[model samples]
Target chain A: MAVSVLTQKKNMPAGNPVERLLAATADDMARVNSLILSRAESHVDMVPELARYLIDSGGKRLRPMLTVAAAQLFGGGAGNAVNFAAAVEFMHNATLLHDDVVDESDMRRGKPAARMVWGNKASILVGDFLLGQAFMMMVETGDIGSLGVLSAASAVMAEGEVFQLAKTGDLATTEADYAEVIRAKTAVLFEAACEVGAMSGGADAAGRAALARYGLELGNAFQLVDDALDYGGQSGALGKNVGDDLREGKMTLPVILALAAGNEAEKAIIASALGKADASDLEVSQVVAIFNRHDTLNRTLEKADAHARTAVEALGILPESEMKTILADVVMHSVRRAS
Target chain B: MAVSVLTQKKNMPAGNPVERLLAATADDMARVNSLILSRAESHVDMVPELARYLIDSGGKRLRPMLTVAAAQLFGGGAGNAVNFAAAVEFMHNATLLHDDVVDESDMRRGKPAARMVWGNKASILVGDFLLGQAFMMMVETGDIGSLGVLSAASAVMAEGEVFQLAKTGDLATTEADYAEVIRAKTAVLFEAACEVGAMSGGADAAGRAALARYGLELGNAFQLVDDALDYGGQSGALGKNVGDDLREGKMTLPVILALAAGNEAEKAIIASALGKADASDLEVSQVVAIFNRHDTLNRTLEKADAHARTAVEALGILPESEMKTILADVVMHSVRRAS
Candidate 1:
């Protein structure tokens, strides 16, 4: 089962760490996909219609892949990882459906948001439906321990959201606040996914803690890159327009950093554009110019690189397997996107 | 424990079964209430704000009370009925939050709906938060069987809402369809409440089955009476405006029965008013007149009476106790409200 370090290095490509993870876990991924589709089915047509719309939408399903991959690495009979993987995917999608409604977002993943087609009410109810299905999947595994982990993550995620909503446009929102927000809203789920994956895979306490830390740091790196991309990356790459975070008054790291460092006039331009919802592209460019002058976007990416390094470091405690190597590479690739 | 039938009858008052049941489970109900309020707390202020708004809005807490009463009826140890009871209340309040948003309701329990005060987005997110908290409470109980039952009920309830939405204005919605809707939307939760209560109370299989049947039939009767009251009883007694269901285009049994028996003109009146969201009082009375012509209100009450009788019959298997008598009387009172 041991591969030479040279072979491992050659097999790890700079591009498509996510794709590599998915391929490594492809067999389990197929089972997870089938479980997801079957559970999304309901006697109510709209339940399936709206659910399938979001589930079938083209996305990497990176979260579930992480789950399956983490389980594969530990190799503990793959006990209910399929169910847990599907549960993780549903949880992630449920948040997306709710997020679009909360942000009044019109587009997701190069397609119209589920809220846009079915309206907000349906989106909300269907999001609840998906969440219910997620719990059902967790229960079916009969792993009460994993159920506790996932359920706690769900609450933390909601609190993170409400916290973000409260701080949406606050100019004085600090870096520490941003860290708390991302930790709860994004990284906690990732940590739970990996931790539960390890639990089902028969990992010892140290192995579980290592994966948890890996997922958390990787999630932080992922979101930081996403925030920087909102200001500097292509809309095609982002799956939305550039500067959406600014338009929505999201106090992302780049904005928080730029605001803290900007002169009086630069601060004025950002304050005017942020949270406007209809802030023109010209206004976005002005904000971007300010971000450039302050070097906040690159600084945000720099922070992402630091976290990605920590994420890779987290994986060092685990035994060297191809899955572990791919997972570490995936963390690096996420931050490399911004670079 | 072996009280005579006559003694049971003498102790049970026909006038206030729900109140009697509440009194019977007062201590457990108090713990459930405290747990509910404590669990509703969050670092995110909006969550507690919106959650408390709905949780404290004068709900009867009948579902949670049933959980407590069912648990207390058996002399089994009260393992975690407090947690299950609070979980049931949270689940009920969660539905109310989402229901207000879906129904576009401006008022609930004689006050402005949460959505009306805080907007639909907050209502939806807070509802999700409460559901998360509900599952967390369930996991704390460490009862996987009961968790499966409640989680299945959650999914079925969401399906019920979506099913009800699908049939909102469809004239072809049959009596069978109406039964399915109510069973999923309302009765399933009741069944789960009693079943889990029995589980927590350390009931044997037969005892659990009996309570489950009791709750299902009582919930059916409760919903049927509420439907009849929408057309025939006082709006003050019902909490919302009379004919609110008709305005929302809910195809309750009374409306379905009237439509089945009425003339084409009557059919037209019912159809036009079904989903208008602003159907006038005169139009409501006209529909009521059609219902009277067919004696549909009386017929709906008859259906409720039949369900209530079944609910009482379900309790016959249990040992004669004050709690059992009060539970039976509560079912009778629910139907008596329509009478």
Candidate 2:
């Protein structure tokens, strides 16, 4: 425990996240972090280099936040969400690191990916290390329903990834198919995000289901918006390259919706553009224009609005608090972000 | 249960593997084709297409055999080794799948690597799937020591991979460093093989430790032999090209020992062969001749012999039995083959 002082902040930040959250969720966050480090400590000495590299990478801690918050929302226990949060975060990062290794993508946010910095092998093995660690965390939670949800969700996520890989670069994907893929790929995290919250918060069956539904809908909208931005936005605003998704041959919602609304000539043109390694800048511009014409951007925004409304509705069972407002804001950010 | 009659083997082989391992691990080579289809059945719909495709593609299954035989040697328990066997097998395959993806390796055991066959993303995620499944299985063993050995070994194996990647083509690898890598990379599984067995079979502390030492030494020799053969054996016999490890810039035992023994001229030859993508046959031949003259092959074999002997020595704690003989023969075969 002497080592804990080294990591503890001498001057803690001003914002009180747990105080803002329902049922002392900020305290829950502190508790979760402690458990995560403790659980990870078993693996720490053995992989001195990788364990240090990955944990110190400073992830945003969004997934774990959702876990604890959901638990608080329903006015139940704090400990369950802490474990769920740690476990879910572990699973999330594991996939991200592995995704980088497979895509050979060089960057994560603004920094180099774990694979780029630590090499692909550590990126992968540490990813695995986290995955196993996640299960241990889940088991510690001792909630069978919670376990069932997380396990089933994780399996589906893997399948979704496989489906995405199979369809990548192919122009045959429809808006519906793209929606399904993104739902599996990204929204499940959102779903887990909300469901784990309520489950840990000790919401009754109907209440917990409501939060899960909210999370599922919100997650779907969030990913659709992300796909749209990855295709349509500029790097200056997005902090990443536009059309990076297209370059990888990923047929996102904008592309799929645009094609469905376009004439045959336009469809064929878009298909040809996707096939080219160097589809002209002019052609890419034309596709973007077609998306605008089809009102795909507006439609995506409308869906996001629906998810945000649903996200708030899911928490209706909870007594209103400042933390509740933040959850609503997070949902807004998920679906409504422009860049 | 109905599926067995549905998916029944067309021609099941006679004789349990316990009876055949004494003939040499090589001669008994074939799929046990059990536990996998049943245990992974929850993901069964995808099994034929996704899970089974790469698994049945022909792997050594050495880890599982080590697990099963180790348990049997100590005295059987009620289906305990079955879980241990499944756990080790899953861990081994998980490593291979991730390894193939990271290494960009196209072939494994003379067949297409999982990444090459199913695409890298599937290989990566399925590897995650199996890993999650492995932890789930190991937990059912109801022994914390079983969980401890398997999880710790998983961490070590992963770290070994990271170390190997970091040290690639670095001429500084000594025998001790190589030994550490091999212990982590290979010996940990061997140790798990024996530890899991002893625990499941109700062996006492002394028996368990002795068997664990046997597996650890056995794995070390097994890896040493594999490394030596990568440089010296026929491509046809090994089912991979000679010096494939060198081609990939992997610093194995022979290469490290050879480099340590070589003069400036010999070192120059090895560097030229390894660093170039378009490495010429003439350059490779020159390095091979230098290795031949340095007696690297003989020295490597001697080391393998010493490890194999140590493995057998560890088994001295066990009472004389048919199981012990089979395990002893396995240690002999580990280093006896030229390839």
Candidate 3:
């Protein structure tokens, strides 16, 4: 429900979905933000030098905000929910540092990636330091239930990353296999972040499960939209280059769905596009054209909408709150992103 | 003292220092061996395949053996100690994985290094996985006390690795800094393994403290020997090329001592050799000649011996037992190893 949480809070206009979502989650995030900043700042020597480059570089803080918003939505804030909200951001940033190293990426949010500026070793170690810090922060919460959830999520996230590496450039990847990897790599953390939020929020088992399902669906939708945008999202808004994933030989949901139902010629073009890790813009355009011709974008969007609808439906059991409406809107916010 | 902790009691032979020490520690090691083997077997996926590979290559399992030996010496059992021992090996292997990446070396323990075989990303993540696994195993103990000791030791080890990386190729390195780094990097794990063993065995604080001190001194002596061998040990026997550390531009205690005492001419040679990471044996030999001329080798041995003696001295208060004697002889057994 904390849609564009950081964006909404930092620069709110008189009225908009971004402002409404940010305004809705403002009180909860204020508490978590203070702790998040302090927790991150505690490792100043390890994180500050390059972290400011990334953090101050301006990320959405979407995941952590989801954590705090989820907690507040559940009407429970007496526990360590705020601390955990901050902890999730630490974990996310840690993975980002390591990912930049693995991807050999040079830019993040228009600034130099940690590896490009501080070297790969620093990126790797600082990433590690953040991971350790996240673990330490979670342990301080003294919530054994949340601890188990977070650790398992951490392991699953690593497994997903490994699986993705092994499957790169393999055109025969199944939707099921790719979805499983995506669940592990992306959804697990999001799902667990929400689950932990609910758990710390004093939600019952059913409530927690509902929130977890919602998070999983949201994550799927987010990644699907991301893939669709990769070939055409505005360079200035999305923060990632179009065609980067395809160039890296990755087949996202749109590409997967497109190739599955497309004609032979379309499949051939798709295969060729993913073959080169540094494919030209012309190749990217051809693939995008095929996507449009085959209606893969609409198909993929339907699948994403199904997930988002399911997420909102899962929240039917919860008592109505302004936060729930915000959460409901997040589904479309990501799917309808301009950039 | 439960010298024969795992298998045949008669395997606890007592004669010459080296053979006797080996025999005395062999039973406990048998238990640790199986646990490490089984843990590696459970994860054979291509992602962590390098982790299994590096582990299966088998570098004597010395660190885990130290844990086992310490447990038995402190009257801890074979069964309960196995996981702790496994934890020690996990940590050691984790360090090796990271170290190989840092050194960019192509070989480890007579096999292709993790970085060489699986690339830097795999090596780094697997290293992180092993560290996480170590903590997972520690958590099984359900003893927060054990968690505290292990986490603190783990952090120290990480700090040491960072310090070593920072000091790489620095000719002006001092012995104190060298000791600090090793203490964090290697000695703390060994020391913690022993102290935690005593703690698990229900030993009083005084007893655990004494054992930890003993392990600390022994580890220092052991690494000093390792440092010594890096400069002077045979290639095949050492399971690493001679001057391997020097090839990584490492400044060991012998080099530090020699550089400190040698005239301007010898100091210049040391700097020149470090400039060449692949410096030949003849080049290393010239540096060795300088060390011999300055008598730094003897000084290094004398320094190692002092630590060994201190390790032995710390055990004076322990009750008389065969395990005690074997543990005491670790000083001599450690420093005497040619490689």
Candidate 4:
């Protein structure tokens, strides 16, 4: 299995390599955190209440950390990186809030989703508020190139979500469709975050392009690992309800692979469980058993490893530095989460 | 009633003044229309489907027209005004989609609300897509000042909606509180629309300030009339289900005024209907009876008249032209909708 292979090859600190990247960007990240908190404020009570509920909730701030780390890699100081990072975080949280409403998800980051506490209407409006604040932060930077990148990402992410919604419950969904879904919904933002960070860091055309490729490949690997984790990882480690993707009928890579490889009887088992909110634990285990028989989860992990390798390769254009090493490790750590 | 006063004064052509404003800015507005439709395109089927449902609906493009007209006022040629106008329209429609979800509205522009057709999830996501596109359009203009104005308006609009939600069914809501709600929820966007249009048109500091004031006052007047109409005007004319505000328990000015002046017996009747989804026509008429007895609807029109006059006065700084005169007429037309 790819997980066993991944585990045997890795020898690093117990903590996530992502954590190391965070430490390298700690000071800039602190400023980003402060700006995030301060900008969430509003005279209208619910704006801050709902915003803080999501922002202060324990997200690793990985996307924004990537933003800051990417900037630092190019020797960018605490210039527009702080604002861009904060804006990226806001965009991520905003999507989370809306996605919860769309998915009817009750749990997020091991806590009740904002929609659960505040109602769908509040969640939706506050999400809009966060996005507005995000754009406001970008505008204040007067960096038109960064603004375009982020805004385009925002549009693509929405399209990705809609496409996923359309494909839900469809067993015939192709890997190409799955790839497009992840690319638009997940990888595009990562690409934009790193690209904008590069732009703010005074990256030339080549450096900026390299960072964008790095972010996209890393994002693809991260999503693949996450999809596999939904089937195999601990719920506590994942910080979400187990079998959520299966329950929601998401056409992730592992499920698609399993479906493609399975016999008729095995397909029937997954069909019954897919999109069933009340699908029993026994049903999920049944599906997992089938996945194991086909080695689909490992195959998914193998694909993730391929993307992660490409992500590391993307960093070759940049001069070697401690930050670059950490970034590369972060890519590996994302895929290793399933290990 | 203020309607009588408005109709008697200096009658312009029988044509709708909004149509006149449209004619004055036809070229730029046509461009804005094309940009709006083009930007709504996405590979995701639902994105364009829901977006077109709202954008192609029969509602007059008043906000974007204000943007184009403001540009024309400064003799602006083909410039960023087209992009800003399209951006303003997208922002307006984005709010409409979300508002339908928040208000549980089934009707908009004399048709089923997008939420009703595509479900609330699609509506929310597509609304988000539009806002993203709006920001992209603004970024493409490379006008950071205009971008800041539009984004700030977006934040205020969300805050306003939340404020209104909090005040829903609040019996003791004050006139000032009601004013604040509309100012944030409605007027700020109008102000931003004209302000950005003026900025794109290369208006001087005084000219920009004047357009901002004009837009703010016009928006205030327009909303006041609309709120009053919720109690008195035809649903067909409004392109909304009559009594929608009452059904949603929106703390509109007429309702607030009636509540303040209402005796306990009348207050009881209003409360019974406020926020009641099943509130019958009989109950609505009962609330209308209370409003008419207090002259509250007339009082709302009078307030609107005051704002409309200020709107015209705000335009006094501009050199008189056919466009300027038509713009002033448009202000009057908005208030006189009740007549």
Find the candidate with the highest DockQ and give its number: 4
TM-scores for every candidate against the unseen true structure? 0.94, 0.80, 0.85, 0.96
For each candidate, the alpha-carbon lDDT, in order, equals 0.85, 0.69, 0.72, 0.87
- What digit string (tens of lDDT, one per residue) describes model 3 on residues B149-177? 66667656665666676678888789997
Cα-based lDDT at residue A159, candidate 1: 83
> Measured against the native two-chain assembly using Cα atoms, what DockQ does each of the candidate structures obtain, in the order listed?
0.67, 0.21, 0.30, 0.81
lDDT of 4 by residue, B1-339 (tens): 634335555757668888888788888888888998899998888888899989999879999999888888898885998999899899999999999999988889888999999998888888888998999999899899999999999988998998888889998889999999999999999999999989988899999999999999999988999898887642223233667788899989888988989999999999999999888887888888888788888888888888888888999888888888888888888987875
Worst 10-residue lDDT window for candidate 1 chain A reads A1-10
lDDT of 1 by residue, A261-327 (tens): 9999999999999999999888888888888787888778778777887888888987778888788
TM-score of predicted model 1?
Answer: 0.94
Runs in model 1 deviating more than 4 A are A1-15, A234-240, B1-11, B234-240
- Candidate 3 Cα outliers beyond 4 Å, as residue runs: A1-48, A73-79, A233-240, A263-265, B1-44, B68-80, B233-240
Q: Return the top candidate by TM-score.
A: 4
Q: Write the per-residue lDDT of candidate 2 for residues B56-145, one digit (tens) a residue.
A: 776667777776666666666436677777778878887888888767787887777867767777788777767766765676665656
Residues B1-339 of candidate 1: C-alpha lDDT, one tens digit per residue: 022222334555555777787777888888888899999999888889989988888889999988988888887655588899898888888898888888888989999999888887778778888888999999999999999999999988888887888888889999999999999889999999998998888889999999999899988888888888887652223234888899999999989998999989999989989888888888888888888888888778778777877878888888888888788878867776655
Give the distance in Å from residue B98's predicted Cα in candidate 4 to where it truly belongs. 1.0
Residue A139 lDDT (model 2): 64
Candidate closer to the true structure by TM-score (higher is better), 1 or 3: 1
Question: What DockQ score does model 2 reach against the true complex?
Answer: 0.21
